[model samples]
Target chain A: MTGLLAYFVFFATIATIYAIIVMGLNIQWGFTGLFNAGVVGFYAIGAYACAILTGPARDTLIGGFGMPFLVGLAGAALAAALAGLVVALITLRLSEEYLAIATFGIGLTVQLVALNAAGLTGGANGLYGLPRPFWSLFDSVQAFNLFYLVFVVVIGLLVWALLARLVRSPWGRLLRAIREDDVAARSLGKNPVSVRVQSFVIGSAIMGTAGALYTGYVGFISPIDFIPILTFQIWAMLIVGGSGSLLGGVIGSFVIWLIWTGSGTLLSRLAPPDLQAQSSAVQVVLIGLIIVLTILIRPRGLIGEKSAVSSKK
Target chain B: MIQAIADGLSTGAIIALGAMGVTLVMGILRFTNFAHAEYLTWGAYMALAVLSVTGLDAGQTGPFRFGLGLVLATVIAVVLTVALALAIDYLVFRRLRGRVNHITLVFASFGVALIVRYSIHLIFGGAAHYYSNDLQIAWLIGDGLRVMPDQALVFALALLVSVVLFLFLKYSALGLAMRGVAENPALAAINGVHFRKILFWTWAIGGGLAAVSGVFYGMTVQIRPDMGFQLLLPIFAAAILGGIGNVVGALFGGFIVALIEAIALLWIPAGYKIAVPFVVLLLVLWLCPRGLFKGSSGGSK
Candidate 1:
């Protein structure tokens, strides 16, 4: 029972973190018509930034700033937003494919910087033993699980409410318009580039916050942690849960995480001991299959975009 | 240095091979096929299988052990890659045709890339393997600057392939139809050019070239799933930097990216090797998206 609870807690922690990341991506791609394939870059920055600020000395490469957790999260968000702004300003003006190229390039540069600037990021070993909220008061594993769950749920609700408002407002309509017809929006005196950069910044900030929560929960941040695979996974979630939907974003995370955990557990039991070492990779491949099959069948996703009610409850 | 020049040329040759696939798909189909790297990875794995299948691992010698084995591997990789590309077109891309927007297609390609890469991992464990360098005996020159027989063979194949491709594209009827479709699909269709047929062929040719590049790349470095994936950024960088639709431009861009990647290793930390291609791509994209060559009208906005 305790093992099951811990596994649930662990998977829930990652799913909540991924929900925020996917929501951020939804804002950029689903709303603003920007294709940012380098979402992991911003996520990593947020994670490493907060990790460095709150980390201890000696073991810390760029850690030991000793800043409070929330403050570090804010700084991380701001940094990611700024990076998004810079990249958007440079490449958002380009067409569809060119934009993809630029964003992908930015992702590589971020990975390189994180890997090379070992003094700041602890290099490949990754930052470990991160301080979690209320970690001190909780002596048992179950207690810590409940504690982090509250923190994650609260943050998730706040993000959900805020994004819901943004999607419903006039800015949201403007975003839809831009996505539908860029030239037409430009003709109406709306600066598509400026709006895109704005959306990119805000979305990237959300991604950073997700990263902050990820670091605090997992208690580690490394260059390897924020690979392109994460970007692909987030995208898969967004697609599976119905892009441009608030409830979908949250629900998608839980569904994908459940499948990942359940399938992994089942496969480990079936496969030989030697092959079990590669189960994580097998899980990754399954995720890819899910994305492809899901996209091919239902491009809008499971929940999909809500339609008007006729005689519904 | 002559050594750097040789290294750059060989590196350029491989990139040129990879970039051809990227350029063809872009010119003909209109979205960057991000899964292009999977072809290279598949080739390397196929080569491994060939070596194991031929049972030449113990004490086999002679030109056939090295030469024929490599050739058979390339052929197998090419066949597999072409069929796979054709399948992707038939399955995902064809359905997406005339239905979705451009950004939708781009995201779809990403989905395909994710699927293909993970499938590779699933089929072949994510471990790195290498072909023995015993056959890679150096030929001539003062220092370790001499070309190995295998390296010379790869360069020769690249040169031959490009020449033949150019001739085909310039002289053949089907090639002309493909070029026409790229120029203006509506007009080409009015002229009775079969649009879908051209796209299928483009995927095949592109996949074959990608496999060739993969074999050469694996011969130089160890074969790992991420090897082809890591090269993707540079491959696209070469495509866009060379001018998206221009074959010759891709060749030059390939060499430029390879030279920069190799030379950057001299100064930067080894971990930053992946960043070199993007840096060059960014420079080219920022300064001259048109690049050094005159691009086909289809590539330009």
Candidate 2:
């Protein structure tokens, strides 16, 4: 029973971290119609930022500020936002496809750097011994897991409330207006580019925060953690939840994560031991099928956008 | 330096073939098909399956590493790949057409790519497979440069395929119709061109070319599920650098990108080679957004 509880806490913590990332995507893609495909890039930047600032000093890497967790979180958000700003400035004025390609490249580049730049990022092995917030305050593993879960939940809820409020604000409506018809929005004397830049930055910052939270929970960071698959997974979550809907995005995160973990377990149990390594590919295939099916059958997602501002063809 | 150039030329030819398909699809389909790269992987694997079934992959044909069986497999693979491409279009993309925006289509293509690539992974395992393990000595081609017979043949075949495609698009009735549709679909529809027929031929030609490229790549390199994805960015860079819809430009762009990557090995670590196309792509986008050969003949513009 205690094991089950611990597992639940662990699962919920990861799901909630993903929820935060989905929320960030919701703002950029769902609300603002900005297809920032490099979610993992920003997530990595945030994770590395937090890890470097709060981690103990090491000989092999550049960082080891030993700052407080909250300060590390702030640094992560700032660094990710800055990276987002640079990408946005370069690609936002171009076509959506250009943005998509550039962002994808950026994500790949980040991973490559984390793999090769040993002095800065500890190379492929990645950084370890990351300080979990208030980890020392707990005794047992279960107690720490429970504590971290609550801490993440509180942060997740805070982000959710803040985003919910922002979506209802006037700026959110402008984002939708631009999304539906940027020309019309432009004619209305609003700077669509600047608005998009703002949205992209904010979304990136949120993704970074999620990365920090992930680092905190996992207590480790590596290039392996920020693969293109994570970006696709987050996109899947947003698409399954309903892009423009905040609540839908969060719900989609949990639902998809559940499906992801459940599929892995089921595949392990069903597949022969010899083929266990290849079963992960099957899970990827399932995700792909889900994305295709959802786009075909439920373009608006499970909990679709509010009808008033729902995208009209 | 000479060896790198030789390798670059062969690799460039392969990329050009892939890029041509990408450009054609983008011209007619009006969205970047991310699954297009997977067509390369599928083509290679399909040929592999056929070769394995025939037990022909084990034997060598003359100076070349491949055999008569590979020739037969190539033809079959082209047909199979075309069918696969059309099937996917009918099943996934055809329904989404006109129902959603181009970005949605792009997203769907991503999903399709994942499915296709991973399906290969699930079936073939992650380990790399070779068509033939036969080793041939590289020919000394003056000034300490060496050229493999396989590379020479692959490059020659790639050029032949490209020239054939160019001529087809220039003179063939179907080719003209495809160009017409790509230029102005509504206008072409009004002018007696069947939209569906053009769309069908686009996939057929694109998939056929992709199959040839994939086979060439597998012959020279190794066949793996991730081969298509590893080459995805380079192919896209080629297509975009040549101008999105321009075939000739894509061909040239492929060579340029490949040569740069080959030469960049002198300055940058080989581990960072994957980033060369990305850097080139960003520069192209920044310097000339419409590509170097926009409004060229044989494309939409």
Candidate 3:
């Protein structure tokens, strides 16, 4: 029972993390119509920033501020926002599709830099021995996981409330107007560029916050942990949950990760010895299939849009 | 120095062939088809099947040498890749055709990429495969230079194919139609050009070229599921650097990308070779998205 309780808490922590990242994506792609495919880049930056700030001075290449986890989290969020601001300046003027491609390329470049810049990052090996949120107090895995999940959930709910507020505001209305028809949106005295940059930077900062939380929970960070596929996975969770819906994003993350974890465990029994080496790989393929099938059958997702016209469309 | 240039030329040739496939589709379809790399993987498997089924891969140095083996392999892979491209067009892409939004098309391509990559994984067992070749045939040619015959053949083939594609795009009625479709589909249709027909041929021929690049790549490197995927960013970087819909730009971009990947090792770690193309991609996107030469000619004429 305790093992099950610990596992649920771990899973909840992950779901909270995805929800945070997806909220950022939802702002860009779902609300503002800017397809920021480089969500992982910002996420990774946030994690690294937080890790470096609070992490011990020995393993780190720089930023041995040796600050508290809270301070590190704030710094990570700021850095992510700054990075997003830079990327947005380069990409926001382009078409949505072009932005997607550019964002993807930027994400690749970020991952590459993360992998090669061994001094700042730990290189391909990744950074370890990170200080968890309460290193001085919480000792057990379960206690830490429990503490982190509650902390993350509080943060996640706060983000949800903020996003929920933003989309409903006049600013939210303007974003939707742009998504539906950009030319029309521009005709109404709204500067699409500024709004896009704003949404992108803000959402990216949220993703950064998630990254900080994720790093704190895992107590390690690596380049391998931020693959291109991760961008898709978070996107999938948002899609599966229903875009433009904060609650849906959180729910989707839980469902998708559960299936992923469940399949990883179940596949071991059916997989042969030779295939065993590639079992996790096989799970990845299944996830890919899941995304494809889900999109094909239910474009809006399980819960989908509530409106009849939108849902039908 | 001369030998490295020769190898670079060979690598450029292979990349150009892949670029042609990508650029042609991007030109006509009006979306940077991200799944194009999957075609190269298909081509490798196609050639592998032929090599396995009919012991035809082995040959002596004649008119029908590795060159001929390549041509034959090219034919099989191209045909299969074209069909696969069409299947993707019909099954996944065609449905999303009217959606002019790039990311939507990207989503569709991601689906196609997932299906193709995993299908290849299911079939090829995710392990590396190779054409049985051990003959290095490296020779000294004065002033610290070396040449490998296989690399030479691959480059020669790359050159031959690029010229043929240039001519095809230049002279043929089909070529004109393709340019028409690429420049402005609505206007091209107004002139009675069948966009779908041109797209069909483009997908087929593009798949063929991607296959050629794949075969040369497998010959030079190793055949694995991620082989084509690993090349995705570099190929797109080249295509973008070359210009969105320009063939020559794709070729030059491919070479620049190849050069960077080749020489980046001097400064960066050996493991970070892939980063060279990606870095070039970011720089080009950040600095100059219009190809160094020009762009798709606007096909305005």
User: Which one wins on TM-score?
Assistant: 2
Candidate 1: Cα lDDT at B34? 77
Off by over 4 Å in 2: A309-313, B295-301
- Rank list by lDDT: 2, 1, 3
Docking class of 1: medium
| Superposed Cα deviation of residue A304, candidate 1 (Å) | 1.7
lDDT of 2 at A22: 93
Alpha carbon lDDT at A232, candidate 1: 74
Q: What does candidate 2's lDDT look like per residue over B143-248, in tens digits?
A: 8898888888877876777788878888999888887888888888999999889889999989998998998898888999999988888998999899887788
TM-score of 2: 0.96
Listed per model in order, the count of residue pairs whose N, CA or C atoms clash below 3 Å is 0, 0, 0
TM-score of chain A of each: 0.91, 0.97, 0.93
In candidate 1, what are the lDDT values of residues A195-232, reduced to their tens digit? 88788889999998888888778777778888877787
Candidate 3 residue spans exceeding 4 A from truth = A305-313, B1-5, B60-70, B297-301
* Better model by lDDT: candidate 1 vs candidate 2: 2
Worst 10 residues of 3 chain B by lDDT: B58-67
Distance from true location, Cα of B98 in model 3, Å? 0.4
Which lDDT value does model 1 have at A83?
Answer: 79
- List, residue by residue over A1-313, the lDDT tens digit for candidate 3: 3888888898888988988999898898777767776778889989999988988786448655678999988988999999888777876776455566666766777788788888878888878888887756776777767888899999998998898899889999888788777889889888988898899899989989999998898988899989877787787788888877777788888888887778878888888878875676666676666666665666677665455244422
DockQ of each: 0.59, 0.62, 0.40
| Candidate 2 steric clashes | 0
